[model samples]
Target: IALTDIGVGHDTLMAEVVPGIDFIIGGFDGRGIREAYEHPVTHTVMVRTYGGVSDLGRLLIHYDRDAGVITGYDWSRISLLAEQETPDPLIKEYVEKNIRSFLKRGVDNSGFEN
Candidate 1:
């Protein structure tokens, strides 16, 4: 199966419905999540978009603590790759934008929305 290729267990991935970005987390062998958090190799995670790829569209992000590189999924399209660069702009911009948007709406301080 496609998941086996990526080592993502089908029965595990926990389905979470984020108001802005829908994604799946826990319920896996930990390898998938560990790898994602580790940034060993680039991986794609699916998200539900109202007018993007489809009901569920795959979004890629690269996370590496060593290089401080937080990369978006389309690394191939980048001139400088995450594996080669120290800090990727894609990751930085994503984080900044998301934070700005969240603060604008004044996200609730009472609960862990995530």
Candidate 2:
């Protein structure tokens, strides 16, 4: 497994160069992978999550302990919907406080309006 910020091409290159790399997770410049991809040559699974805090990527690997290798995998991207999900009180409070501070500073709060 590897965590990288060098983007997809490099991530794939790393997998090609290195042996026994079953997975690579990467993101760059707020860009994200809409779907997971596997390299044809190396058969390494690569996935990335959205850059901000709104979405999460999940990868579940099926491993063979006897063989010491990955057998298969499952991947998904989960969206955090505010209307469907309950917010943590502490985080909500902190965000609200920051919004108030930005407003006080005339920081153009229009962009943050939901």
Candidate 3:
């Protein structure tokens, strides 16, 4: 397993060249991948996040303990719905406070406005 910011093309090449790499996860595109891709030749499974804080990628692997290999897997991108999911009170408060502080700071040395 490996995490890389080198993008998918390089990741594929790395999988082809490197031995014993079963999974490669990462991409340079901030938009992220819609679905996981498995290389036909190397059989390496590739997964990427949906980007940002709202969406997250989940990978469930079925591994054989004795054989020490992944037999199968399931992957999905889960959307964190605000209505369904409740934010942690402490974290929410901290983030809100930070945002308020940033807004109060106004224009910076770079002349960037909020």
Residues 1-114, candidate 3: write the lDDT tens digits: 898888777887988888888888886765567788888888888888755565788888899999987899998987776776788899899978787666687956575875
- Model 3 global lDDT (CA atoms, 0 to 1): 0.80
In the order shown, what is each candidate's alpha-carbon RMSD? 17.4, 6.8, 6.4
State which candidate has the highest lDDT.
2
Across 20-102, the per-residue lDDT of candidate 2 in tens digits comes to 88899887756678788888898888898877766898999999999987789999988775876788999999998787777
Per-residue accuracy of model 1 over 1-114 as CA lDDT, tens digit each: 013222244422322222323233322232323132211122324322222211222346556779876545421112223454577688888978798777777776763453
| Greater-TM-score candidate between 1 and 3 | 3
Worst 10-residue lDDT window for candidate 3 reads: 26-35
In terms of lDDT, which candidate is stronger, 2 or 3?
Answer: 2
Q: Report how far off residue 8 is in candidate 2 (Å).
A: 2.5
Q: After superposition, how far is residue 100 of candidate 3 from its true place, in Å?
A: 22
Residue 49 displacement in candidate 1 (angstroms)? 41
lDDT of each: 0.37, 0.83, 0.80
The CA lDDT at 85 in model 3 is 76
Of 1 and 2, the candidate ahead on lDDT is: 2
